[model samples]
Target: MKVLYLGDLVGRSGREAAIKRLPELRERLKADFVVVNGENAAGGFGITPAICDDLFAAGTDVIVTGNHVWDNRDILPHFQRENRLLRPANFPEGAPGRGIGVYDVPGGRRIAVAQVMGRIFMDAMDCPFRAVDKALAAYPLGRTVQFTLVDVHAEATSEKMAMGHHLDGRATMVVGTHTHAPTADHQIFSGGTAYMSDIGMCGDYDSVIGMQKAEPIRRFIHKTPGARFAPADGEATVCGVFVESDDKTGLATRIDPVRVGPRLAETMPEVV
Candidate 1:
């Protein structure tokens, strides 16, 4: 199974860049499943139903989120019925949306996707390690599911790395999100799972982690509340990880990064 997991989409530019580039990417990479982190798609806060629909229309099979999943308020109710959209699975049992989703990929293969937000430097939540463990246990790879992917939406790199190592050999890929900055540590663990500290954001890299520069800079320098942070509207970058998993064992066979757009040096994965 070939899967492409993209980083977070910040705002309009991110959303537009994703919508514009995803379909071609899927074809270019020959990706069988696509998962994108749309947590910060709404003006850099939360996602909405309309935006979710747009992302799906643009070729996203599953959309995962983090702490900002509920920022748009409307997404709460919408999330309850949307199977493609997922929140952190460890959110107190009765959360609006589920954290794991099972979807049929091409060739009639089924894949499960789970998202868990880390507690370190992030909002309090259930143990992400435990949450993912339970999810994977139920959807055992090479048995109940052909492929399993985990998106660790987190703030701290250590926590994300821990999750990757914790789920190694169990999931097809363990990719990180929420940091909005892509890391260079893309590798396949000895356990056979593909991992990346972060896939980065699909927004402009010229700002403070996707937010407009002036406000975040002002707050840091003046130490006073100036205004709300806004998404940078410059040329955007589409960044993420690409993994190809073995069909029989459901473990990663190859792992690489996919980056495009104006903000970053363009490079498409050598998918062949």
Candidate 2:
């Protein structure tokens, strides 16, 4: 099966680019499933219900989030109503939404998607290792679902890589989020699981990780509060990773990175 996991949708430019190109990309790539990280789909902070719906309509099967999951209080209700949206499972027990969901992919195959937050340099949360272990235990492969995708929303690449290695062979893919900078290392693990340190952001590459640079620069230079952040208004590069996995074992056979649009080189991964 062919699966596409996009990085964080930073803001307006990211959303626009994704919505504009995703349908064609899906058709051209013959993707069976698509997952998008929407933690920053809103005005570079949090995603709203409307934005989530838009992504769903645009061909996203599952929406993953990270620390910015609670930026908009209005989204609190949708968290309960929509099982397709996932927050970090490592969050406290009383968090708003679920962290795992199963969707039926093409050919009647079941795909389980889950998110876990890293503790290093991030908000205090339950240990991601234990959280993932619990999720896997609850949804064992080959029985509860045929394919499993884990999104390790985190800050440190070391932590995300650790999670990928830990879950090697158990999951179909383990991809990272939150850094908003696509890394070059994308490959299938020895265990047949697809792994990448970070899938990056689907936003304008001209700005500071998707936000307008003026505010962040001012804040950093003066050490004082300034204007709130907003998404950069520019042509965005839709960034993500593509994975081809075995239908029966739920293991990846190939993994590749994808970059398209302005501010970045055009590159597409073909399954090997």
Candidate 3:
């Protein structure tokens, strides 16, 4: 099974890049399933239902979100009807949307995808470790599902790495998001799970974490709120991770970083 997991999409540039390139990416990478982080797909805030529709139409099988999931009030009602869009499972019970979903792939196979947020340097939430354990208990890999993906949408790399180690043998891949900068630590754990601290954001990297540089810079220097932050409108580089797992064992056999577009050196996995 081949799964492609994209990082967080920030604003118009990132959203357009992902929507425009997803079809070609699916074809070129031979991805059987695709998951994307759309937490910041709006104007550098939360995503809306319209953006979700656009992504779905473009080939995204599932969309995951983080703390910014609630930035857009318009998405709250849509969650009741959309199972493919997920918020962190660690959110308090009765949260608008679920954090985990199991979907059917071709050939009668199944894949489970879940997102969990870390508490370190983040909003207070339920224990991510416990939340993940509870979610994965129902879907045993190689038995109940052929592939499982966990997105650790977090600010701290340590928390993300811990999640990967904790779910080492249980999931097919454990990739991180929310940091908006790709880490160079793509590797398969001893237990067969592919792990990467972060896959980076799908937006212009020239600014401060995809936002326009001026406001953030001024705030950093003046220590006072000024203009609101906005997404950089420059050309974006679509970033993500590609994982190919063993069909029988439901473990990752190959993992590679994928970065396409300007500003970032191009790297893609061989399509074998």
All candidates' TM-scores?
A: 0.98, 0.97, 0.99
Clashing pairs in 2: none
* Candidates 1 and 2 compared by TM-score, better number: 1
What are the candidates' C-alpha RMSDs? 0.9, 1.3, 0.6
Tell me the whole-model lDDT of each prediction, alpha carbons only: 0.91, 0.89, 0.95
Q: Higher lDDT: candidate 2 or 3?
A: 3
TM-score of 3: 0.99
Candidate 1's TM-score: 0.98
Which segments of candidate 3 are over 4 A away from where they belong? none
Model 2, 1-272: lDDT tens per residue?
Answer: 89898899988999888988889888878899999999898998899999988999998889999999999999999999999999998898998889888888767789889999988898899999999988888777766777899999989999999999999988999999999998988988888889998988999999988989999999989999978888898889999999887788888888889899878888897543
lDDT of 2: 0.89
Model 1 per-residue lDDT tens digits across residues 81-136: 88999999999888897889999987878999999999998778989888888877
Model 3 C-alpha RMSD vs. true structure (Å) is: 0.6
Q: List the lowest-lDDT window of 10 residues for candidate 3.
A: 263-272
Which RMSD does model 2 reach against the true structure? 1.3
* Best candidate, lDDT: 3
Decoy 2 TM-score against native: 0.97
> Candidate 1 deviates by what RMSD?
0.9
